[model samples]
Structures are given as structure tokens and as C-alpha cells.
Target: MKKKLLVFLLIGVLVFSMAGCGNNAEKPKSDIKVAMVTDEGGVHDQSFNQSAWEGLKKAEKDFGIKVSYVESQQDADFAPNFETLLDAGNDLIWGIGYKLSDALLDAATNNPDQLYAIVDFSYGDKTPDNVVGVVFKAEQSSFLVGYIAGKMTETNKVGFVGGTAGDVIWGFDYGFQAGVQYAAKELGKEIEILNQYAESFSDVSKGKAIATQMYQQGADIIFHASGDTGNGVIEAAKEQDKWAIGVDRDQNYLAPDNVLTSAMKRVDVGVYNVVKDLVEDNFPGGQTVVYGLEEGAVGIAPTSDKHVPKEILEEVKELEKKIIDGEIEVPYNEETFKEFMKTL
Candidate 1:
């Protein structure tokens, strides 16, 4: 009887342990796995790549989905990194930059069933049925900052450092120049702008050298649309006790006193919305999503340094409203920019 009782108790403990194990086992994996492929800038670029990654992280938390990313060190890495993510069972893959257009297009064409998205590029009539292109009105926000830079310049000379000479970056350049020209007309002051392209987003030394030369040439404020290279621009500004404008993200936190403001491009919002749509089964494929000031996806960062006058800030706010209301048309390219300059 004693042996039987002991055996029965052991069996009961064993069954309970088995039940607990079954209950604690991880739930079946989430069906929706999303992944991102970063451009040569890498994920911590503190600009474009960082913003996109933040969106992926948000989707992972909000939807209980699986997410991953691969950082491409150079142009050659794009296709392989994309394929790796797909092979790893990602339901959606995002390429974060205009440079990835060809690779992404090829991949989407070959794998017609896989969903893909690319930032800063649009195929227009050639858009694939399974791909969505995300673009931004970067010029609109750059114009705002350019106006501020014009008003704040002590020397009446400002500078712009662009990462690359492309339609996307050109939008920033033209909008900035137009804004400066408008501000010059308003203030009845002669403003000069010195513009240069670093030709590389990752070359910090090149950015710093270009900015330093501009500053030496009497430019009191400089704006950079370079990626990680902008870091060097900010450093040069701080060292020289000058002002700098940032791009893509609000970078005033980097040097609150030195950074006048940032031209904001809400890349994170774009990425988040794309993933949310995918998860919710309403993915808007075969279309280009253009986010602009009206959509609150682009704007100028708040002036946190107290260098910009209250009246000037108010004026900028009014201009923002005008742009959003379609009362003010910001130029997006060189030709329109020149025409806009003529009007000013």
C-alpha cells in the first residue's frame, strides 16, 4: 500500500510538471515577419537609416510581429542582403534609400509574390504590383530652414552641404536657396549662399572640410543634408561657435546651442505606416506614397537655441501654413528654383 501511494504521488507530480511545461512553451511564432535593408549609411546613421529602423521597432512592439534588418556597407551589398532577408522568411522587406531602386526592382520583378518597398524612389508608370515607393517633399521643409538661416546669419552669407547631387537632394538645395532668397527680399538684405556637395554621405572629413571653408569665407551658418557626414558639420560649427542646420532628423539635441534647427523628414512615420498597412491587410502596393508638409511628414524642427527671434519664428510658422494650404508653392528642382529666385 505504501509503495502504491508513493508511485501515485510521483505520477501526479510528473503530470503537473508536464502540464506546466506545455503551458509555458512559447506560443507559435508570429506569421508576419518584416525586415529592412539599410543603405551604405548603416542603421545608426542618425538620419535616414535610423528613422526607418525606429519604425520597424515600433511595428514589432505594437503588432507583436517579428522584425529584422541588414546593414549594407556598400552598393554591392544591397541585392544579397535583400535576398538574405527574404530567405529568412520575412513577409515584407524594405530598402531604405534611392540607391536601392534598381536592386529592389529586380528582386520584386523576379519574386512577384514577395512584397517590397523602397524609400526616396518612385517608378511612376513602371511600378511593380508588389512594390510600394515612398517619397517625401524634402524641399518644403528645407525652405523653412533656409529662411531661418537667412534671417539669422550675421554675415549675410550661408552655406549648404549636400550629400549627393540627385533629384532628392536637389529638392533640398532648391528649396533652401528659394527660402534664403525670399528672406533676403523680405529683410531688404543681400544674402549670399555657398553650396557644395560632399558626393558621399559617409565621409565626415569631407563634410567638415567643405563647411570649414565656407565658414572661413564668412558664412555664419551652414546647413548639411549629408548623412553621417553631417556629424562633422555640426562639430565644426560647435568648434567655431557658429550655427548649423541639420537634416532628416531633429539633431538639435546633438548640440543644442550650435544647432539652429533641422529640416525634418519623417522617415520613421513613413516606415511605420507602411508596416502597419501590411499587417492590417490593406497594403497599398503598386503605388507611390508622397508625404509632404500637408501630411505632416516634413517640416522644420523647432528653434530650441533662442537664437531665432520670436517674430521670425512666428513668420516661419505662417509660411508653413501657407505652404500646407497651397498658397505658397515651394520649388523642388533647379529650374523652378531659378524661376522662384527671379520672382524674389
Candidate 2:
């Protein structure tokens, strides 16, 4: 019996030694690192760029990846930042905002072997095999807010302030206008909408001045798509004790009483998804990712009950459903959108 026990103990020791050796023989996973380039609005602007940064930070936490970022001081820095990130041996480079599209395209083309992703814009003709484009259907949420404003307006007057004049900014403008018109027609209400563009995203003073003018013109609810510049619009609304809608992330908390609802663009979700894909070895390159109502990437922030009426809340819920169910179509271009506005 003693001899048998000794033989069993020897066999167990040999098995443990072989298993430990095999474990050490396996190769470690490659380290994945990502970097982001912010547009004109610096990081922590509490808007679009901030949201994207938050997403990247989350990816860093989840994947154990080294993350770095550079805020572009001027437009010229976009290409240089991309070059610096690639040259630094980053596994992926992310460009935030539509303003960087041209630069991103140039850099991505020059560095064909480097993987790149961008938000808010895409390559005009064809995307390179290593480049991924991310865009949001901001109209989904903008439409809901338009419906709410049209219903809640006492003077039949609403306003939309855009950050720029182009397809990118107009996408929000046209969508909001269409939503207002749709609700006005169906609800048998009369609401007038005033639309204007600030021509830039960083000038908060200009946004404030424009918003103040709209209020003087009898606009009770004004929606500003400008970045930090929109904060000035909110300030104007607060000073006047009127309502202002926020864009990209919830600004309702920024001014609880004055902010009605936010048109959420889910920029963070876009950044997180791309990083996750790269980490999981499912990189979605050479593809344009469109996040819309169905994906929960673009929609309206929940209305803080402190400001909005219950009826308005119910109306927004119904509109969200229709948008998701495909019963309502929001117009997205100037000409077609202008015709739709006539119905309001």
C-alpha cells in the first residue's frame, strides 16, 4: 500500500509540471492602443466632442488599452495630429467632428497601413480599406423636439440656430423643421419657425446674440445646434426666463428650468463601438456606420419633469415611437424641407 501511494504522488507532480510549462509557452495578446483628435471645440466642452472623448475613455477602461488624445488648436492641426498619432505607433486614430473630414481623408490616404476612424463625415468618393466613417441620424431626435416645440408654443413661434451652413448642420436644421411641421399639421396647430446659422461653432457670444434676437422676435422655444456656443443661447434663455433646447448630450441639467430637452447625437456610442471592434478583432473598416433611431444612437434626451408638461412628455413619446416604427419620415434637405414647412 505504501509503494502504491508513492507512485500516485509522483504521477501528480509530473502532471502539474507539464501543465505549468504549457501555460508559460503560450504567447501574450498584442497591446492595442488608440488616440483621438478633437476638433475646434476642446475636450470637456460638454458637447459633441466631449461625448466622443467620454466614449474613448470608457474603451480604455474596458479593454486595458493605452489611450491618448490631442485637441486641435486650429483647423490646420487636423492633418498633423493624425500624422503624429500614426507615427507614434497607435493602433487606431480617431478624428472627432465633420470639420476634420478633409484632413482625415488626406492623412488616412497617406498612411494606408494605419487604421483610422472619423465621426460626423466620410470620404466623398471611396473609403480606404483601413478607414471607417461614423455618422449619426441626428434628425431622429431633432424631429421629436420639433414636435414638442410646435405643441407647446403659445405664440406659434419657434427657432433653430445652427452652427454652420452645409449638409452636416442642415441635417439637424431640416429635421427639426420637418418635425415641427408634421406635428403642427396633425395636431391642427399653427407654429412659425425661425432658422438661422451662426456660421461657426466656437463663438458663444454670437450664439447668444442670435438667440436673444429670436426671443425678442417672439420665439419662446429656441434650439441651438452650435457647440459650446449653444451654452450662450442657454444663458440668454435663462436671462429671459424662456425655454432653450440643447444638443449632443443632456444640457437639461445645465439649466434645469430653462432647458426643455436635448437632441442626443450619441457621439460617445460611436467612439466606443469603433474601439471595441478593433479590440475584438472585428474592425469595421472601409464602412460608413449610420446610427439612427432604431439603434438608439440618435434620439431625444428624456425631458426633465421640472420643465416640461405631462402632455408634452406624452407627445414626445408617441413621436419617438413613430420615428422608430417608420410611420413618420423627417425631411432632410432645404428645398423639400421648405415645402414641408408650409404645411405647418
- The candidate maximizing TM-score is 1
Per-residue accuracy of model 2 over 1-344 as CA lDDT, tens digit each: 99999999999999999999977764222467799999887787779989998998898888778888999877989988888898888989999998998888888888888899999987744988889999988877888888778777878899999987887788889888888888788778678899889987878899999999999999999998988789889999999989999999988988888998889999999999988888877888898998988898987786545667888787777877877787776777788687666644
- TM-scores of the models, in the order given: 0.90, 0.88
Error of 1 at 79 (Å): 1.0
* Candidate 1: residue 100 Cα off by (Å): 0.6
| Model 2 error, position 300 (Å) | 1.4
The parts of candidate 1 lying over 4 Å away from their true place are: 1-29, 303-306
Alpha-carbon RMSD of each model: 6.9, 4.3
